[model samples]
Target: MKIGVYSYFIKNQARIFTALVLTGILSVSSGLTLIKDARAASANLSLETSSDVSKDNTKSNRLPRPVANAVLQDLASREGISTRELKITNYNQQTWSNGCLELPQPDEACTEALVSGWRVVVSNGRENWIYHTDSNGRSLRLASANTPSNQLPTSIKNAVLQAASKRLQQPISQLTIVESQQQTWRNGCLELANPDEFCTQALVPGWRVVVSGRQQTLVYHTNQTGSVVRLNQKPNQSTLTPVTIPVSELPPPLDRDVVFRQISSGGFAGTTYETVLLRNGQLIRVRIGDANDSERSVRRVSVQQVRQFLRSLERYKFTQFRNLSYPAPGGAADYITYTLTSQKNTVQYNDISQNNLPSNLQVVVKAWNQITASAQ
Candidate 1:
């Protein structure tokens, strides 16, 4: 009886130990399931919470409101969530369609506006509005225009942007300004890949200092001296300034009746001058003379300027010159073409085109040595 009781106690203890081990395995499996479920739920919530502005079609529904909302509802149902949270607060989305937006509210830092057709979105930061277009104005990822004010000297930025814009045939509207920093002119010079001499020559005409953003995109214009300017890619340089010359300083039209006095020792001596003595329509005293002329008359005047003096003369007159061939100096089988202006006996031989002549023919000037004499 004593041996049987001891064996029964040992058997009971073994059974109890086995039961505890099984319970622990079941508990671990249950905890794993709970953890997986919680993670799955969190992932679903995150996916549904993202904004409907994705450009990728796989991520969200098409635009134009009703469709987007329907797609949102479908997504919510699949995730076992209520549609109430998915309701778009601002479906008007005028800011998303047109590139127009008011200044950011007190708490907000920046406002984004979508530029139609470009897929480009512009963000208006504290100081300036940045564009989302790429170097060529093709649609590109949205980016900011912020540069620490101290980084690039405003001068470097301005020059690079203006040069790039002119080179790329792109409007400032399409450039995305990424990073801008202060840089010395020497450090920022770009080595052009194609080396277009004509385009490069225009890089900094007249003393223009350019302010550019990170991509060397032009943002503003200034003079070489670094005065703030307001020119926006104007080909004509005159339009950039503010000073308007009043008409008071202009010289009055020369009076045909008043004989002009000649200074004996001036730059005008000995030269024949054509002046508008009585320019009542192209009829000027065609025989005006400089101070040195044996016959002294009025001093020489520009034909165009004279027309400007008397507008009526412009209609009656036109410029004419004569092109003719002349004998060559060397007497070889060669001749030169000369152009004689209507008023002057002087002949000018153009030297530029002689190289392009055929091998059999050579070009030379006949009376070129006598140009000064001809004028006399």
Candidate 2:
């Protein structure tokens, strides 16, 4: 009896399935031979059935086949699992953003914005892994699913927060727990290190807790039992000392003893406005138009507020901002320049956003803007 083409195709598919089942034990060459044979059989079926084979060809061509294969093989080897045990759940071409990397110390070269890359999500039944790769399929990093804080037991959360508070040397009420998540901990080990011996066995499970203080945000890493393993260093508080500035750098036409000149520029083509804060808490606002046309308004700001602004200026080390610049995006940039002067020193810095500014400086800028807007 002659076997029908459909029957032969079904039998061939069963054989390919069995070959896949045995892939864990099969040699790489043997596995490839089986795959090649399966493809040849599929091609033969299309020829006999008069069906369009171009669809099959195009489907195979759409993905970066070699890259995908290499990723599967590498992941399986690292995980000590069969390739068949891993399933590719999702994949897409991605453009790298500023925070695309989640590694402890990401490659500096890969941090460029708008770079082309690929993100592949794979799973092995119980856990999911995400692989980030460059356009050339070079693996940049691997991240696993994080257990959300809400899902964690309340005791675990409390323990972690307590540990964080102890590390920060602050009371629990003073520190705010920003976030917590369960993640695989490498304990600062290399990604390519032996997973079984170093990373997985050494630090299999961990939690990352983030807390915010008055001066900075701190990240803490802890084990499953909520014991602190590591924490990031605090911001450089030693540099917060006061700075002296010369009186000559103040904008002209003001009193010869003016100590601070805050020139703010905004609107299209950069309109100018200025605020002069003297040493005795007196403030003068000047609005300038083209050709040096100007109007001045005067007010006595509270000594407390003046002290706060001065303290912020010193804390943020604004004097260090001289010659620092940020390119403004077209039609959307506003510039703020703070020039502080005393009898012996002068410093000026300009930027478009408060993100680069210290928290105290940010508050000072907001207050200055309010005062300027009122004068307008």
Candidate 3:
């Protein structure tokens, strides 16, 4: 009877241990299943949130109201200008590649892979500032005017006013001095044509006086001795006389029916990248490297956007910037060339700095850069 009882106890104890072990295994499996489900639910929620934000962005065309306000505050702080004085003239949306951050490298060719952002143009009456922001309204860059300003002596200011009044055929009282800044005379003499005995081979210190009248403004340069030397004369004086050129005599008007070809190339290698704007308003960008490698990208733009682009070109007077050149001397110096074509005409310009571009041409180039950066 004692031996039988011991055997029974041992058998029951083994069964109980097996049952506990099985239960623990089941518990661990259930816990793992719960963890997996929780992870999936979290992931789904995150995806839904991201989709909603994208939908909201797609539905909105205008910049968020807060963005403008934030930009105003930031720009005023950086430029030391009053917010009230700054006017937001233009706002544009575009894909902003991080390429510009890589200074001295030709901007990476614009591609669909780049991030989207905004470009805002602001003005403080006398100068314009370009501000770039990411989609989140964070400032990326603020390109403020870099024009230099130097105060003039009271005597020098008076002399400049007198000279400006005579040249503009306006009384001293009618003319108001808008600005006076020091300039280095690059030419040998301050005289418009004939050099005085004081003219030297070395650069001479001078003053630039801007006098404004009700109808027009006159720019004058004065030597250190306060003698008026040169006037900001109109270019191509011979062509100043208004003579009507018959349409038949003029080059055929550009083919406005459709965009033919728009190509822009720039970089250290002379042609590091090329962007082609198509008739359908799509952009095809190609990055040229060594013989073995090249990258390409395509971006689609709206018909309305393309039409507006053509309209913007209307403001450009091809004649004004024609024959003008800003030479870059060194082999590795940066250069940009724009070649635009239509059925009727093809025009091209190359320059080292857009700042040296004519006023109207500068506007055109600015618009082009903004469009290419965003669309490509």
Q: Which candidate's lDDT is highest?
A: 3
CA lDDT, every model vs. true structure: 0.33, 0.55, 0.59
| TM-score ranking, best first | 3, 2, 1
Best by TM-score: 3
List candidate 2 segments past 4 Å from native.
1-256, 288-294, 320-323, 329-352, 356-360, 367-376
Error of 3 at 133 (Å): 16
Off by over 4 Å in 1: 51-376
Cα misplacement distance, residue 209 of candidate 2 (Å) = 24
Tens digits of per-residue lDDT for model 1, 1-376: 9899999999999999999999999999999999999999999887776533344653332234343444345423322234554443222112233232222211133335544322222111212112232122333221222222323344544555556667666665544333222222211122122233332323332233333322332333333334323334432232111111123522233343322111111122332334222222232323244345555333344333332322211121111011122223233333333332222112222233444322112211222122222221
- Can you write out model 3's per-residue Cα lDDT over 109-162, one digit (the tens) per residue? 333346677788888777676767766665455543222134455566678678
lDDT of 2 by residue, 1-376 (tens): 3568889999999999998878856777788999999999999997866656666766644547655776788666444356998888888777666344433221123354565667888887776767766666654555442212324445555775676677767777766554455667655431223336555445457765556554445665666766445564442332121222233544444354464676666555566777687655677877776456446668776554554554445444343333223223346445655553432234444565345444444565565555445432
Question: RMSD in Å for candidate 1, one decimal?
Answer: 26.9
Candidate 2 has which clashing residue pairs, if any?
245-342, 245-345, 246-342, 246-345
Query: How many steric clashes between backbone atoms does each model show?
Result: 16, 4, 3
